[model samples]
Target chain A: MEGEIRVGIGTDADLVIARAEGRAMAQRLGFRRPDPTLIATAISELARNLVMHVGHGEIIMRPIVEDRRSGVLVIVRDEGPGIADVGAALRLGHASRGGLGLGLPGARRLMDEFEIDSQPGKGTTVTMRKWRLRDDLERLREKRQQRG
Target chain B: MSVAILRKGEYFIASIQSDLSDTEVLALRDDLIERVGRFRALGIVVDVSALDVIDSFAARALRSIALAAKLRGARTVIVGIQPDVAVAIVQFRLNLDPLRTALDLDEALALLELRPERKPADGR
Candidate 1:
């Protein structure tokens, strides 16, 4: 399942859908327990940033596999007034528009890898991923079962 | 609309039925604060077990509800935080100070109950 699930983020209701989709994708990709919850929370924060700041955006989620590690990837993009200072925006307690300013920073902490690209007066795009490693025993069992 | 708010004696219990949008969260916060004043409630119990993800905005909104209720002479206790949701929130490191939480509805109600300090008997 390499297909990407895209959800348009416009209003508050859209945030709910994005979060649910993120969690569902993570679960389908075999993320266990708190990882799915963490993925959902991260999606919530990023999508809220779109609704609160840009008024509109899109979130893309996909399952990715690299070697023995599999994970979920999320990309949020918005074409509003871009962040001038990415560093300040990432800093906790820095509210640019009267928000709690926990969106980007909190999302970064929840995901294993996070990157942001933005140009002033252009737009912003955030890419994040959470990976789960396959245990040696599990891989060996799967291989033996496949051969049998 | 998914939230059910009921008056239990001197407290208002707002039980969330499902995942709520930001607007719904704000509406719940406003409704609880207003009910506390209109009914002269001594406390408010908000049940959030139905919510799978309590992000920064929702958490902040809950805190706002608690703070507003406190200002009106009422205490607020949140209940039924799912285990996975709790783990996610802790990792976010969101400052939830001054917001009381309980395991379930019973615990939340107990926490809201007024328990007077016991006095020692004096022998003459």
Candidate 2:
């Protein structure tokens, strides 16, 4: 089964709503307690960036299942001025405007897999995936049993 | 908006029961600062037990509030940070080291009570 939710980011209230929606979606997708929080935090960072930089943006959260693994995927898109240096932006403690500077790297570290694409004059799209740890452990156990 | 700042003896307690947006966080900072001055509180306890997620903006606001309270002769303690939230903060490389933290509200109160009387020369 696949499910998706879209949230528009325009103001600080939108950030809170986005976080709540992201957390709820992750939970509905069978993510555990902390995983839901992580997803929510990532969404907050992205939403805050959208409001601060682009003035508006969109966040899409979806559930995915591949092979025997299940996970949640988050996509954040913005039409703001794209990052001039993707590598620098991913570095910790690097703030472009004026904040903690944890927006991009922090989101990356919170998820299992992260990818970003940006064009100087166009926009930026961030895609992140977090796999279900229980499923991964179960798959590992199955592999061990098969080998034995 | 439901966050309440209560005065308990010489300490002020601000319990955040819901998710706060960036604007609310800023308002909280201003409110806390004003209350610290008005009540002449000696200590402040910020309870974030109900917050499932705290982004960089919220975290920074909390830190700034703590600093502002300190300048106003009030000690600040942050309590009820979830383990998952702690992990996320560390992963994000957010520095909350300057702020005093406790596991829960009870511990925070105990810690504040145990502190020696504020020295007049103890600036910062």
Most lDDT-accurate candidate: 1
- Report the poorest 10 consecutive residues by lDDT, candidate 2 chain B: B115-124
lDDT of each residue in A16-133, candidate 2, tens digit only = 8999998888888778877888889988998888888888989998888765778988999988889899999898878888655789899888899999999988999999999985
lDDT of 2 by residue, B1-124 (tens): 8698888999999999888878787988899889889989989999988888877877888899888998898889999998989887877677785789999888999998996667688674
Per-candidate fnat, comma-separated: 0.85, 0.89
Model 1 lDDT, full chain set: 0.91
Would you estimate the TM-scores of all the predictions? 0.92, 0.90
Stretches off by above 4 angstroms in model 1 are: A137-148, B115-124
Candidate 1 positional error at B61, Å: 0.7
Candidate 1 clashes between residue pairs 3 or more apart in a chain or in different chains: none
Clashing pairs for predicted structure model 2, backbone only: none
| Model 2 alpha-carbon drift over 4 Å, by segment | A133-148, B116-124
